[model samples]
Target: QVTFSHCVPTIVQMLLNAKAAQGTDFKGWKITIGGSALTRGLYDQAKARGMNLIAAYGMSETCPLISGAHINDELLKADEDTRSTFHLKAGVPVVLVDAAIQAADGSFLPADGSSQGELVLRAPWLTQGYYNEPEKSEELWADGWLHTGDVAVIDEMANIEIRDRIKDVIKTGGEWLSSLTLEGLISRHEAVRDVAVVGVPDERWGERPFALVVLGEGRELSAAELQAFLEPAVAEGHINKWAIPQQIAVVSEIPKTSVGKLDKKRIRSEIARWQKEGSAEQTSLS
Candidate 1:
């Protein structure tokens, strides 16, 4: 039997082929996906093969493995709806971890499925302090709990759905928009291979989201098509219509930092340079 703990689409395909060659005597599979975000298409393919796949969520601070979907339980089964929700959620906290969502004023809110707050945790295996940095450690645990820096909402079932990073959430005209949610929705388009949404300066809205997109090979998508796809989301009030990007830049690939995460800072710098050069060229033409 072969099981995968964390894998991308490419690796999952390889495992599926390998399992088929092993014959009917091979035992069932148990797979867990816990890194980055898994698309709905990948989840459906794995579930169809009777491969027991569960979505797990955690971070490095808690020695990872905070919570995971139960493989055989009906309540935790991965279905179309569950898979969609699971992809957005961080799952319920593990048995040993004490997790809560708190407001800016440090008051605990009810897990009524609509309130949003900062995720804070206290667990046995969590790190105690930052090595050789007492000041940083003190700041990290100011309220006697490890501040996760993630904004999330907990439903009645205690499932913790991560909305966005506190810093990454876009505040436009007094409304907050989730960049992660927007990115996931945009990436579902066939022409889009990968996408990222970042908050950029706007005089009217305070801040607005700008899309950084990577298209599939030989696929060309216009800014209008991207905007059209987002129209329904805006109409439903999931995002402000005005929050949509004024420009969508299609690139060969999004640059990532050494840690393999999207480098938004670098993207912002590039945008600034491009604007400056464009202004200089227009001045010379005039």
Candidate 2:
């Protein structure tokens, strides 16, 4: 079994090389990918090697593995696109667990799939409250449900696909761009080791996405290649052309919080410092 908590291309390459060296037929190998969004390219590569790949979805609050793809005959016989869609989806709710989407005002939305709202869950196993923090517990359950702090869109099949964190959605030029989406896309490139996408001030576009990339050791890639790779996605309307990011800065590493999530506050501070110093060499990517 192979898993990718984050979509690191080098790890994918290692898996492919190992598979080739083994020369063993992939009929029995089960490769399950989770944690971050899996790219179509990586999914296709694993499929070509005859490996059984599945997608799993969960979070730390849910004890992980809330729901996972079933390798049943029905799913196995599905078309490539269907399978890919399933792979991208968050999957159905597990038995004995209840989930719903709620608005900011604490009203539940209908399961119509078009409504965008915060995810609220009720599972028997979830923690009753934060340890030694009654106030925090009350705040978390203000609406009588476990507020997951995640924004998601459910489909007709009841598959909950996470869109972005409510706070991470950047409003630029009358549209919202998911930082998670941009990060996932940028991390797919071979040169990238770690990436963080954030919205920075723009005189024209209101707020534009900027990528802070930590390149893999000994790998060199230009900004033009990254732009070109994202062009097709823009053309396909997956994201706005303007959202393709105005700049890509190759940094040593991104600062992270103690919990390991990208520390956007630090990046914002760095950008401000650079702007104030008039550091043209470090600030300009083009």
| Estimated TM-score for each candidate | 0.80, 0.74
In candidate 1, what are the lDDT values of residues 62-102, reduced to their tens digit? 78888765333654566767555564466777898888889
Give the TM-score (vs. native) of candidate 1: 0.80
Candidate 2 per-residue C-alpha lDDT over 6-92 given as tens digits, one digit per residue, 9 for 90 to 100: 332335435664635556555556666556555554556566676655665667767866665554578679987777767755677
Deviation from native of the Cα of residue 225 in model 2, angstroms: 3.5
Q: Once superposed on the true structure, which residue ranges of model 2 sit more than 4 Å away at CA?
A: 1-35, 39-53, 70-75, 110-114, 188-194, 203-206, 214-220, 252-269, 279-286
lDDT of 1 at 106: 94
Best by TM-score: 1
* Candidate 1 clash pair list: none
Candidate 1 lowest-lDDT run of ten: 277-286
Candidate 2 residue 58 C-alpha distance from true site, Å: 3.0
